[model samples]
Target chain A: MNPLIEFQGFNKFFGQHQVLADIDLKVQAGEVVVILGPSGCGKSTLLRCLNGLEEAQGGSLRLDGQELLGPDTDWRQVRQRVGMVFQSYHLFGHMSVIDNLLLGPLKVQKRERREAQAQAEALLARVGLLDKRDAFPRQLSGGQQQRIAIVRSLCMNPQVMLFDEVTAALDPEMVKEVLQVIQGLAREGMTLLIVTHEMAFARAVADRIVFMEAGRILEQNHPERFFTQPQSARAQQFLEKFSFVESLPKTLHKELS
Target chain B: MSFDTAFMLSTLPAFFKAVGVTLQVGVIAIVTSLLVALLNATILVLRTPYLWRLVKGYVELARNTPLLIQLFFVYFALPSLGLKVSGFAAAIITLTFMGGAYLTEVLRAGVEAVPRAQLESGRSIGLSEGQLLRHVILPQAGILSLPALFANFVFLLKETTVVSAVAVPEILYTTKNYIALYYKTYEMLAVLTLLCVLIFLPLSLLLRYLERRLQHGQFGH
Candidate 1:
């Protein structure tokens, strides 16, 4: 099948500093790809570029075969097919969880209030946050807010979801709940591109793992091979930094044994 | 010097009548000022080049100079240029213009306080720029800026007293007239004090309560 998203020699610059350099990557439809990287490696910038949050200075980027890098492309329209979740749970803090969920459908799609309300309620129920319908975001826990942030994007009916270190700000106890919700989405066959440091979650959910360093993809492989036999020295060094804890996937443990 | 019961009693209706004038100026000035501030702030935050500079200059000029000089310019100085602004018009204009400067700073803080992530989320959801502003940015900014905005509103209401210099028959102007006519400084001053306290104190208390509720996340209002 054709790749759902393609990045061909993409380059990004921040005032003479290159954040992304000739980055080549592809994401297939219904596939889960986790980008693991050291800090400042431009992983989050890559995700931001997909949805037009960061403009690429060079090369072709395509979503579903449509050109996304040229002047004619309306970034607003491009964004409709892309969803993003930030580390901070960027919920509309002044709005109730239900309002936050309904805003896109109501304002962007111009859906009837009742219809949007129904969708929001259903999504909230799915996430087990139904009771928070009337509660403001500040009143919710970091995990709950992140869940609401996820459902808020899902309410827009995006073709692919981009998560940038979504659980980075959550307490350790709160991380599992959010990871479970994301795993549920992956199971439902929603296309996902994630930037994360959670190795276990990445290994458990990612069909393919792309390891990036210094603004380029250093190596990529199936989760099993990536953990067991990282192809590049940088990838091996990166993996060495993480302890081989009990949570390491069985495939990797067996390969090690 | 001593209290004059009859003079105070007779002038009470005129003072009460002037309260309407004072509040009219205050209300209109408040509404117009808020609108100006919101528009100016949006332009600044959005980085509209020439317009941002223009608004920045206006805000700086208003904030730096005294309100009396601004009012005097509008009411007294403009007549030489054959632009006759009535004292009432001048008062309203000056107050709105000056208040806009202060409110713009307050609102700009609010707008900036909304983390960039919030705007990015709004954009990622396919919100247009206007939708992003209305639905995402402004509401959150308003909440963040509410306490300061509340304080500014009361401060603006009190600033309406400065219009007495331009001969607008607001509360203080009327009180001055009563002082001149009756020469009972203490009694008329007492009436003026009573009226000021009566009108402003309860509203200030009420807004303080609302602001606290907002802080506590009880946003039902």
Candidate 2:
């Protein structure tokens, strides 16, 4: 399958500090890729660049054949095609959950309110949040807000979804529920680029794993090999020190072997 | 010194007449000032460097100088500049511009308080700049600005007393005529002060209540 999104020689700078340097990556349709890195490794910046939220200093970035570098690039169209879920769950505080979900489709796609409402209701149901359609973001738990955020993006009918540490703010108990919802999306063949620290979820959902450090990719491999037999010394040291890194169950290890 | 009920009863008709003019000036000035304030605040927020500097200079000059002096300038100076306006029109224009200077700052704070995420969400949904301003930013800013706007109106009401200096025949001017003719300075001044309190206190309370309600309703959503 042809790559749906590609970044070649991506370089980003914030004043004098180089955040992301000489990065190259590709993601194909219906493939789930998870990026893992230390904090301040420019993982979030990389995702922001894909959606045109943060302008890159230098690189050739493309989403489904369109270049994102030039001033003439239609950013609004790019954003519509690639929906993003932020760590903060930045729901419009004045709008209801249903309204939040409906806004993109109604405004960008020009769907009728009733039709958009129907789509929002169905999407909410998929995220197990149909009962809270009229509720506001502040009224919901962090996990519920994050799930509604997920449904909000899903309502846009995006071709590619970028999840940026979406569960970082959730309580430990609530993390599983969000991860489960994302796992469901992965099973349904959504093209997903997830930035997460949850080792278990990353191991379960990500078809390919990319390990990054100091603004560059260190290793990329299948989840099984990446975890059990990391080739890069950086990846091996990273796995050794990661707080949640315990070897997989004997049965799962046997399956990988 | 007799407490003459007949004298008080006789004064009622003229008092009511003066009250009518007071309400007219108050309402007209408030509406005019609100429109001017909205325009001024929008220009300030847009911050087109040259226009922003000009607006800033105007606001500072208007706010720093006395309202009475501004009123005198509008009433006396403009005619010398070959622009003739009636006393009432001059009074309204002066008060509107004066109140607008303060109101612009109130509105600028309200507009700035809007979360960055809200604007991003609008852009993500592909709202045009005009639609975003009208449907998203302005509504939120208006809600936030309501309390400050109401306070400015009260200030404008008090400042309308200055128009009496320009011989506009508003409440205070009419009261001055009564005091000069009837020699009931103490009684008339007390009654006029009471009238202002009666008119503004309740309106101020109502505005406060509305502000609270709007704030709660916005957060509740």
Task: Report the lDDT tens digits of candidate 1 across residue range A1-257.
Answer: 78999999999999999999988999989999999999999999999999888888999999999989999998887777798899998888777788888888888888899988888888889889999899988778999999999999888888999999999999999999899999999999999999999998999999999999989898889999999999999999888878656447666334544
**lDDT: worst 10-residue window of model 1 chain B:** B212-221
Model 1 DockQ reads 0.43
lDDT by residue (tens digit), candidate 1, B173-206? 9999888876778888889999999999998999
lDDT: worst 10-residue window of model 2 chain A: A248-257
- For model 1, the stretches where C-alpha displacement exceeds 4 angstroms are A111-119, A244-257, B1-7, B209-221
Report lDDT per candidate.
Answer: 0.90, 0.85
In angstroms and one decimal each, the interface RMSD of every candidate reads 2.5, 2.2
Q: Lowest summed-lDDT stretch of 10 residues in model 2 chain B?
A: B1-10
The model with the greatest lDDT is 1
Best by TM-score: 2
DockQ of every candidate: 0.43, 0.29
